[model samples]
Target: MKKKVGLYFGTFNPIHSGHLIIANYMVEFSELTEVWMVVTPHNPFKKKSSLLDNHHRLEMVYKACEDYPNLKPSDIEFGLPQPNYTVNTLIQLEEKYPELEFALIMGEDNLKSFHKWKNYKVILERYSIFVYPRISKGLIENEFLTHAKITRVPAPIIEMSSTFIRKAVKEGKNIKPMLPEKVWKYLDEMNFYK
Candidate 1:
């Protein structure tokens, strides 16, 4: 059987525990062999000014994921063009790692805007999607919920945010609870997000 890998794409401005929980839950509860956290260079919907440099974000993810054997930190987008889109990224990944069958992983809240994603139809038709939940939107019920391509994993809603962590960091507050020990230490030593 082909290796089943779940791609959890995010900016990971700083990879926190919430991200690990979701990625961890997916691997333990689903058919995925491993969950690769794909650090995005930039998000079209988000402000570029608010983002840390892609290399920095990528390194932080590497630090955060080092302890989890099944959780990988990927810089796939670093080689892609500016203003990258998901469809393109997926295409390139599949081309490069044709031996692995890829699945898309996202939170339930993302389902609210799933249709707006570029080439979403092709994505749903070709790959599987694992949807985890967030604290605010613990569950989602819709026609898409019944779609064969989508699977709602019963993972607990993680109640943390990178924004909240960043704010706490800037205010000189300890955010150990939201981050991995190594990542928190790295951020503190580097004086990042201040």
Candidate 2:
């Protein structure tokens, strides 16, 4: 059987526990053999100023996933062009690891806007999508609700956000509970987001 890997792409400004919970759930409860937390170099929708350097974010992801053998930290998008699109990243991953079957791991909130994404149709046609639930306002398109490739995994609804974490850290709040121990230590040591 082909090794099935779910690609969970995120900025991971400082890898937090919520991210782990979702990834852990996907790997443990779903058909995915492993989950790769793909650290994005840049997200077109988010401002660049708030983002930490690529390596710092990657290091945090590495620290966050080190104890979990089934979870991995990936910096594949780092070498790709700036403002990289998911479709492009998927294509690159396929080229690099031809033997592995790649799937997408995302939240239901993102599904609402999946249609607006660049080459989203191509992603749907070529790859499977594993969607975890989110507490968000928007309605998911009916097409996605019945889509063949999209599978709704009943993972825990984690209502955490990197922006909130950053804000708390900057305000000198003890946000340690929101992050992995190793990640919190790294962020504290580096004095980031302050």
Candidate 3:
């Protein structure tokens, strides 16, 4: 049987418990065989400098997902062009790994603004979308919903965020439970966000 791969792309600045929980839930509750955390080099619309170094962010993701066989950190975007776009990434992934089926995994928050993505219609038609809810206006009500295979995974809405974590670290606050132990150690050793 062919493996169903879910691409959970993000700028995992410092992989936290919330991400892990969602990956676990996706694997357990969905038909996906693996969830590849595609570490984006840069988000086209967001400020690149705001994110941690790509290598550092990738390393943190690797540490956080080390225990889970189903979770992995992908640096596919590293070799790709600057300001990586999802459509291009997906197309490359499909061409490179023809045997495995791919699905786009994202939060409902992203879905609300997904139409702004370049070739959003092509994305909706080509791949299945797995949406997890965040603290937002709830699931997106869009025209794409009618044609897209959208699955709502029951992922916990953790109030923690990379922005909040970074702010806390800069202010000398503790983040013991918010982040994975290995990731925390890495941040401490590297003096990141200081």
Candidate 4:
């Protein structure tokens, strides 16, 4: 049987415990053999200035996921282009690694606004999507639902977000428990978001 891999893409400005919890849940709940945290250099919809440097963000992710053997940090989009689009990245990954089956893992909040993505229809047709609940309202719906192989996983209700973390750091507050110890140390050492 082919190895089932989940491509969990995110900015991961500074990976937190919430992301890890969802990732662990996805692995246990789904057929995924492994989950790759594809660190996106830029998200077309989000503002650039709000995010930390790509390398810095990637480093933080590496530290956060260091203990998980199944979790990996992929820099595939680092050299691709600015304002990375999911469709384009998927195309490249598929062409390069045909032996592995890839699934798109995202939170429900992203699903609510997924239609705005470029060539989103093509994406749904090409790969399966594993949706985890976010702080968003309502269920997943729309034209793409019928075409895509979709699975909804109920993640732990930890409303921790990177935005909230950044705010706390800016205010000189401690972020214990909200983030991994190693990640927090790295962030503190590097003085990120300060």
Candidate 5:
């Protein structure tokens, strides 16, 4: 059988326990054979100034995922053009790893706004999406709720946010418990977000 890979895209400004938990859960409990923590170099919707250097963020993801055999860090988006779109990345990944069946791992919150994404319909037609629960207020598009390509996974709802983590670090708060031990050490040594 072809290996099934779930693409978990994120900036991973500093990968935390919440991110690790979801990726680990998806790989172990879902149909995915592996979960790739795709470190996004730039998110078109977010400001570049607020993001850390891409390599630093990738390193953090690497450190955070090292202990999990089924979890791997991916830099595939780093070489892609600036302001990359999900559809484009998916196409590239499919071309490069034709032997693997790739799927998207997203939050319920993202699913609510999935329709607004560039070429979202095309994405839905080509690949499956694995949605994890999130405490979101808005309504998911009724169509997405019943879409054949979308699968809702019963993963724990982790409310932790990278934005909150960055704020805590800037304030010199003890955020060790919020991050993986290795990630915490890397963030501390580098004095990021302070």
Candidate 6:
């Protein structure tokens, strides 16, 4: 049997506990052997100016994922093309890791704009999609995906975000609970998000 890897693509400006919880939960609940956090340099839907340096984000993800052995933080987007699209990244990953099966891992909010994604149909056809529920986001109720192979992961919804952590740090608020020990150490030592 092939190892199934869930590709959790994001611009993890700073990976948080919520991200860790979701990725970890997906492993035990879904058809995933491991969850690979694909750090995107830039996403088309998000603002470029708000994004931190790709290296910094990748490093932070690496630090955050240190404890979870099944959680692999990937810098795959760094070597690939810019304005990283999910389809392209998945294709490249499949090419490189032919031994493993890849599935797109995302939140329900992302699934809300699934139709807006470039070549979304191709992505659905080629790879399976595992969507985790968001605290504030609604369920997946798309008409286009009437017959799509989408798996709803019953992962616990922790209402947290990198943006919230950054804002808290900027204001000199306590953000220790929101981050992993190693990640908090890296940020505290480097004086990041200040």
Give each model a TM-score: 0.95, 0.98, 0.95, 0.93, 0.98, 0.94
Candidate 4: tens digits of C-alpha lDDT, residues 1-194: 76888988888878999988888777877889889899998887778788888888888888877898888888889878777688878888888888988889987788888877798778777788988877877655566466437777776766888999998999999887788899998888988888
Q: What is the Cα-based TM-score of model 5?
A: 0.98
Q: What is the lDDT of residue 156 in candidate 1?
A: 83
Q: Residues 1-194, candidate 1: write the lDDT tens digits.
A: 99999999999878899999889999999999999999998888998887888888888989888888999999998899888888999999999999999999988788768888999899989999998876553445465779999988999888888988888899989788789998888888888889
The digit string of per-residue lDDT tens for model 5 on 1-194 reads: 88999999999987899999999999988999999999999898888898999899999999998899899999999889988999999999999999999999999999999999999999999899999999989999999989999999999999999999999999989999999999999999988999
Off by over 4 Å in 1: 136-141
What is the full ranking by TM-score, best candidate first? Answer: 2, 5, 1, 3, 6, 4
User: After superposing candidate 2, which stretches have Cα over 4 Å from the reference?
Assistant: none
Worst 10 residues of 5 by lDDT: 42-51
- State each model's CA lDDT, in order: 0.89, 0.94, 0.88, 0.83, 0.94, 0.86
Tell me how many residue pairs clash in candidate 3: 0
Q: Each candidate: RMSD to true structure?
A: 1.6, 0.7, 1.4, 1.7, 0.7, 1.6
- What TM-score does candidate 4 reach? 0.93
lDDT of 3 by residue, 48-165 (tens): 7778889999999999989999998999999999877999999999999999999999887898888889998889888899988888875566574664487777777767788898
Candidate 2 has what TM-score? 0.98
In model 3, where do residues sit more than 4 Å from their true spots?
Answer: 146-148
lDDT score, candidate 1 = 0.89
What is the per-residue lDDT of model 2 for residues 57-117, given as tens digits with 9 covering 90 to 100? 9999999999999999999999998889999999999999999999999999999999999
True-structure lDDT of candidate 5: 0.94
